[model samples]
Target: MRSIEDRSSGTSGDDGSSGDSIADAAKTVEEQPAFQAVARGGFLMGGLVHVLIGWMAVRLALGDSGGSADQNGAMAMIAQAPGGRLLLWVGGLVMAILALWFLLRTWFAARRGHEVKAAVVDALRWSGPAAVYAGLSGMVLRFAAGGGSSSSAQTQSATAGLMGSGPGRALVLLAGAVVIGIGIGFVVVGVTRRFLRQLERSGALSVGAALRITGIVGYIAKGLALAAVGALLGWAAISADPDRASGLDGALTTMAGLPAGVAMLLVIGVGLILFGIHSGLRSRYQEM
Candidate 1:
């Protein structure tokens, strides 16, 4: 019979071999044409959603329409267009593929050697983008399947439910704080042009001044929107009122109620449009 030490060594070798195989498989999939196509398509889908939301916001700013002014509103708009459902199906599948790709990429990245603290931070940061992509994919699929829900309504309902429990308010507050921090980070990334790090310098430099301009405006606008949403959530938690926590739609609407609100909305709307363009460009120029 084999000694216990011999069995342990054999098991270790098996584990090491399996890990190497997985790493190689991930690398091959990462370089595949099909994977690249889907990843780029996912970026386009994101851009399309942003464009729709921005257009809706522009209309709302001009008092031309009153839509949800969020991703849900974007879906509704898409559904009204010709062959929208088909596009939604395609977009959903692309997003799902992108999410899986991101997961694999993140896994490979985490396995690389680095300081423990740096690795942890990198993992957390990448996990956020992965989560966002996954959530968007799920949302797209739901819309494609004709089982959609208003983002604002969902957020409010969630807030309301949380407020019902003894520790619910605290939980809501914690969530609000986290979102606010993310918003601030977004702003920093924009102002510092840190987003360029994700793109190939050679490709990004070809865009010249426009890239810098759009990157700055887009990040700030998005950050502000996120901050507004977080503030609303925090307020709702404090007041014990879910109605005040109506998510992005409510936050944008609130902005419309302020002085020169229309002008502000128009500016923000333009910023979002620029951001959409930037996102689409990323599909072409991203480091992948």
Candidate 2:
């Protein structure tokens, strides 16, 4: 009878272990999920922005060359080519569609009181403008260099170049440069300890220090990635390499054809998206 009891007890222990395993599996599935509907919209918007920018670049590449052209001129002059028009038409249509998608998502998310979702969606809002700014910046700056500000090339150079040719110019340019640097710095600092402190004061981040730390860590990781991107882009721009593509998508596409660049860009974008998702997830977890 003692031997029989021992066998039954061992069987119960094994069953308990199995039950625990199942519970753990279920928790993992629940905890590790894509952000609810809103995030999906943001992701799509970013991807579309990248694609449209790439399409613009590819179109420029296929355009007519005006001869004596190096890479920058080649790209700009390509705009004058026949293929550019088609690309512009199709690209414009697609960008509009994507923009509408973004607007609708933003509206619904806001209606649902998803502020963080709104912010994530707004970041994507920059994507289209960023692409346009990049393409035009390249075209105008490269094509006319010193004397084309009024000639349809309203790129960042004009804004970023006000420094130091004269006392007034120097101060203005310096200030502008400072602001631009700070803006980029926020991408990484957005997840910093100081930011958390500020948030705590404002009651924006209320999950206590532990969850805040994890969330900050995630932000810092994203910031780190964006930092690398910012560095590469900054270097290429500072060196005045007109041949280089404007954003990561453009840069990657130029460095390695569409497929590889798209894959790399996708990974980077997804990582950032997930980092944003972490905040919402943590809030949900806390409620539980």
Candidate 3:
């Protein structure tokens, strides 16, 4: 048998080799051209969603109540278009791939040998996009399967169920707080122009002014919308009124009822469209 020191050295060597192998494999996958392409498609799908939602919001601002101004509404609108089902399926797969990409990024960040706190922060940041993309993929697939549900209705139902129990109500409030934090984060990212960090340096510089304008307007609008959603959720928990817990559609509708809401909604609508355009640009220039 080997001596104790020799045994420890062998074990450490084995662990290090295994870790290096896994890291290399992950990096390889991340660098694959096909994976990168799919991820870019995901960005376009996201941009399309924002564009549709913005259009609906603008229509609402003009007193058109044709549809709900949310993701479900957007999905429904697509379903009515020619070849929409096939498009939904393709979009769903792309978004799922993108979600996988984000998850891999999160894994890489966590294992990058950075300081523990920094690694954790980086992992958490990537995980947020992973979750968002995954949720969007699910929404798309649900519609593709012809089993889509109204987002506002789902929000209200979930809120009501949670409000039925003490722990659940607490959980709802916590969720609301988390959403608000995310919204604030979006605003920060926009105002600080931090999103440019994810793009290729050369590409970003080429369209610097256009990218800056659209990104700022888009992120701020999205952040405000999310903030409204969270506030309404919190209010629902406090008032024991789940009806007020409708998602984005409800948030926009509520805003419309306020004084000068039409103008506000119109501005937010345009801002969201600009955000969508920014996402489209990101699809081409984002760092894979």
Candidate 4:
């Protein structure tokens, strides 16, 4: 065999080629350092929050509604355990911390780039906490308030524990509003920067442009859904009678009570589900 330096794995320009490869990779990364950095930051704040919400919704759907927040009967299931209570408070703190981290991350992104939009940065500064805290309320209300679903056993599934009456429903509504505000903040900022388009141009993806679009749009839609859900819950909390106990019954219950307003909320809910479907389908083919 020839000497090692002359071998195929160690050709004449091996060292030179290796150096060039590294330099090229580094140059590519630094070219859009700001965008890459912001993507990480966004993942921390908003992306993490969305993941948590999805988890919560899935859990709630599966009969693990956490606390009795909306479950009159099941309240005892979680509250009876002292450890579970502590776990809840810890969960809330974790969520709040992540939210705060994201807020600061965006701020830092703008600061680092020296050219980030002032308005987008400012909007990010406020919306993270507002949306996160509103999300936390879903848990607190469940564990602490013992949501007041109606006596019917089946109605217990969809109802939030803390949202059993007029005031409670009102709080849900406000939470929805905050969530919507946060979503709009993201959509506006993302569009202004042409975030998704730029990524594709930069060769950051392999495939699924159409699917990625669906996912991105779905994310915004989810934000809108949060607002609508909050509003509907808020209305239900206020109008829902403890004695009336709508339980886990979803939009149908509201429609029975407030035909006009409930009708509108139901439409919003349907739109949200459609977005969810879009997201789910897109996720089937997405990479990250």
For candidate 4, write residues 3-39 as lDDT tens digits.
2223334445777588557646644543454534433
**Which residue pairs in candidate 1 have backbone atoms (N, alpha carbon, C) closer than 3 angstroms, thus clashing?**
none
Whole-model lDDT, candidate 4? 0.42
TM-score sort, best first: 3, 1, 4, 2
Candidate 2, position 89, lDDT: 40
Model 2 CA deviation exceeding 4 Å by range: 1-184, 187-192, 200-214, 251-270, 278-288
Q: Per-residue CA lDDT of candidate 3, range 157-241, in tens?
A: 8888888877887788888887788889889988999998887765345587778889999998898888888988888878777
RMSD to the true structure for each prediction, in A, is 4.7, 20.1, 4.4, 15.6
What TM-score does structure 3 among the candidates reach?
0.92
**Candidates' C-alpha lDDT:** 0.82, 0.40, 0.87, 0.42
After superposition, the stretches of candidate 4 with alpha carbons farther than 4 Å from their true spots are 1-100, 106-211, 237-288
3 or 4: which has the higher TM-score?
Answer: 3
Best by lDDT: 3
Candidate 1, 68: how far from true, in Å? 1.3
Worst 10 residues of 1 by lDDT: 1-10
Candidate rank order under lDDT: 3, 1, 4, 2
lDDT (10s digit) by residue, model 1, range 52-146? 87887788898866678889899988888999999999998898888887787777666666555555566666677778889999999899999
Give a tens-digit lDDT track for model 2, residues 160-190.
3533245434444344354346445555555
User: TM-score per candidate, in order?
Assistant: 0.92, 0.29, 0.92, 0.36
lDDT score for candidate 3 against the true structure: 0.87
On lDDT, the stronger of 1 and 2 is 1
Model 1: residues with Cα > 4 Å off, grouped in runs: 1-11, 203-206
